[model samples]
Target: MTDTLLKTPLYQAHVDAGAKMVPFAGYDMPVQYGLGVKKEHLHTRDNAGLFDVSHMGQLRLKGANAAAALEALVPVDIIDLPAGQQRYAFFTNEQGGIMDDLMVANLGDHLFVVVNAACKEQDITHLQANLPEDVTLEVITDRALLALQGPKASSVLSRLAPQVADMVFMQVDNVSLMGVDCIVSRSGYTGEDGYEISVPQDKALELANALTAEDEVEWIGLGARDSLRLECGLCLYGHDLDTETTPVESSLLWGISKVRRQDGARPGGFPGADIIFEQIATKAISKKRVGLIGQTKAPVREGAKLFDADNNEIGVVTSGTAGPNAGKPVSMGYVKPEFAALESEVFAEVRGKMLAMTVSKMPFVPQRYYRG
Candidate 1:
């Protein structure tokens, strides 16, 4: 995976903006613009910020049984997904672990899927290996993905594509922006009201320039993107989640519809369904992912062990950051279910010292999605 560094269609655009380039998932990506991470993170919360996420993989799955085939991989009810609707899903391993988390959209004629850049190749392979012969997978490498996020995101985007102004959260549709055909989705990762646009690679720079030129939209980079998602209590792939983690253990049970669990419409169709469904009914999972707020300013990073009040090693921090909006250091980690109660006193082992932390609720900042 590290053999060659890949560049997105907007590579030159990022350099032109004076972005600090770094290697991410084998791609040369912008870590931060001159605005810096803190300001960019706050701007995306108060105003609008544009992100070049073209490094992620987009694919089209088609055929009469595409939904059914996709359901076999993830726990979500893709077959029940309405046209122009998007659903968050994860590819589960046979042993009940997650292969990767992804977003899937029912585009009527086909399924539009976006997977993490790090796991794209393996995700495609897994899908192809399990899907029926009739199902088809098409890698949409000709497109660039962009995310415009913040409270004012919609107002700015509406100026260029007013039709999307009516689109509610998790909705997707083909639209024209700057006279270029693109797929626009009413969703984002920053826990803010926003949209993700999939534009043709050839027009990537043109669209990036047009959007960033807007007063409300400033160019954001990977650094702000990470801190933003972290503050939102969202998981970053390869950090908060991995092949060793299961949806149940990660407290993602809400994503697994009841119809697929206990005595419902279609129970147990996907991989590890028995184990997952059993955990749902019995609540037997050992560890649960929880939010932690550092009682001090010292932020804990990944790999920091967590300890119970009794000084017993209980868990480890998976993702952490100085929560800009929360005005404190916040983190996400997995702990034994017994110690996961809200407000439970725990200690994070940071540099040989036990720092006080409390088990807090996620979305450290309240989510502001425009569901309507």
Candidate 2:
């Protein structure tokens, strides 16, 4: 069965380190290492954890009108984005439903986009169909992506690439790490100070080994990655977000840049702009995404039904886990708009019984991104 699965550049390294391999997004990826998920989760919060994320799709959008052409597809201020900076964005359908969430970095002459692994092919096709003749999309297939995350990420990376120390959150730069040319970004999905390094496929294993060789760094698998992001309140595309979920309904209105809003300079040109703007203005969303904290020891998992005080079904749990760092069961799911308030009591049906949960403010742990 594993013979048919796609392998990343670091697949051998993961196996060498005793990683439990699993199928994710058509790739044979690591779900946990010998250190275990709980220890891996705490290690990332306390030190550094290296993640192999090469399955994600990388694309370079080049052309003089690339920024403008891309802006017409998503509700983000892509035109005004300063060079060497990154922004979070998503593709919206005609109904204002989010197709996928992605990160866009202005690379001066072009835009560097990192999209969800599962949606890459679809995203590439979408861009190809919608973008004008002036813009050319190049799917980067020969590069591997690695994420070094934690409070000590900077120190660990700076040892190999001193220039990375100068970069702040959301900043991107081309630097030579261990003599290898790479694109390094001071950004990551985990709510921690980190660097996402894009290196040549041939040099990926060498770079991964160098980073893991650091005393403060260790191999972290997908299990810990999920828990870390969950504690940080980050959304996982297929689960917490989907094509039918609009940004407003997902409580992701902040991702819609101010300049692209109804009152902003270049207003309402993207797909579903009219519907998204109406929802923003009228505050008429039926359900909204919110953080959930299990009041009991039992973990409330995805697909679990949620209910209100009167036992009325309100929503379903999208993601949940025993947060090693948060020290409890943390989850995020959609609930009726009226029951989305912080401290609001809700019940999650687990194992044929309702488990107590509460609506909580997210980043159940505080975000520690280095903004300076």
Candidate 3:
């Protein structure tokens, strides 16, 4: 009954299915359904799990200057994207800090963008206020998002729509399914070979019902979603990334396009171009966000202190959890570059005791993306 709670289109469905709802990013989203997080996590890894992500924000950019205007906002080379291709980019602030990360899909003549639910409103405002006069931003709230993720996701989806089997990772296409037009993209945050489907608001339920009718597909809630992304080394917005973090320090420099890092000629004229460009030139970052696996039962949560062997606090935990796949307490946080090397030993302060930790290579679980 809180006035601040926003509801996704499948809110009623979740309620009817006995989901335990909680407030997240202003939405009354299901934390876990009748199945617990552990069960849901295993189900998604073995078979197919459907997640209602309609709370995520989708938008379209149109006009002759659409690509150019978008390029100005992020470090990615959006202007160079080919038709029907999708590229991941970041939204930066004036001080070279990342405001949010987004996916930009070049749908032929125009651009389709998907941003996190927590950042949609601000992202839209930023685009509207900063984009060139020739470009126009259109919010696509009339659509719904569904993610079918797992080893069997492709099989289930292909059965529903044959053309989906031909789609490669990060590639998107418009196709008709069950008499409804839908946009399907072979991409997901769970490190599984999956697809994200965008459908008309009215037809969303019908499409979801059809997909769930398959024996391989089960409904998944947000509880397992977090653990899945964590095991995959994907950063969560407010926890691991924020307006205070930059793409470079966050190990997201790959998202920065080479053309954007050219000599005096910056690719785009967005905020903090100078600082971002300078970092590209120096290649010397002050701190780095890296992954760590510890040998202790005490779970390190966000804001936990990261200390060197001598107990000197070096950084803080951005995100931490008991990785279901890793079967251990794995975490990510920012640390001084010197202590961020692979195999470097460190400690996480749990209460008053220091738990042993080491800087390890991330993606504790291997990614199963089908690029070919």
Clashing pairs in 3: none
Ranking by lDDT: 2, 1, 3
Model 1 clash pairs are none
Question: What does the lDDT come to for candidate 1?
Answer: 0.91
| Candidate 3 residue-wise lDDT, 1-372, digit = tens | 646798878888888878899888889988898889988988998898999998899999999989988998898888878887798898999989999999999988789999999999999999988988889899997899999999999999998788888888999988788888888889998888999999998998888888888999889989899888888899999889999877878998778887887542456477888787777678677889999888886667788999998889898888887877788888999999899999998898887889988898989889888898
State candidate 2's TM-score.
Answer: 0.99
Ranked candidates (TM-score, high to low): 2, 1, 3
Q: TM-score per candidate, in order?
A: 0.98, 0.99, 0.96
After superposing candidate 3 on the true structure, give the runs of residues whose Cα lies further than 4 Å from its correct spot: 263-268
lDDT-best of 1 and 2 = 2
The lDDT per prediction is 0.91, 0.94, 0.87
RMSD of every candidate to native, in Å, equals: 1.3, 0.7, 1.6
Q: Any idea what lDDT model 2 has?
A: 0.94
Per residue, candidate 1 scores C-alpha lDDT tens digits across 97-166 of 8889999999899999999999999998998899899999999979999999999999999999898889
lDDT of 2 by residue, 295-333 (tens): 998888899999998999999999999987788899999
- Candidate 2: give the clashing pairs: none
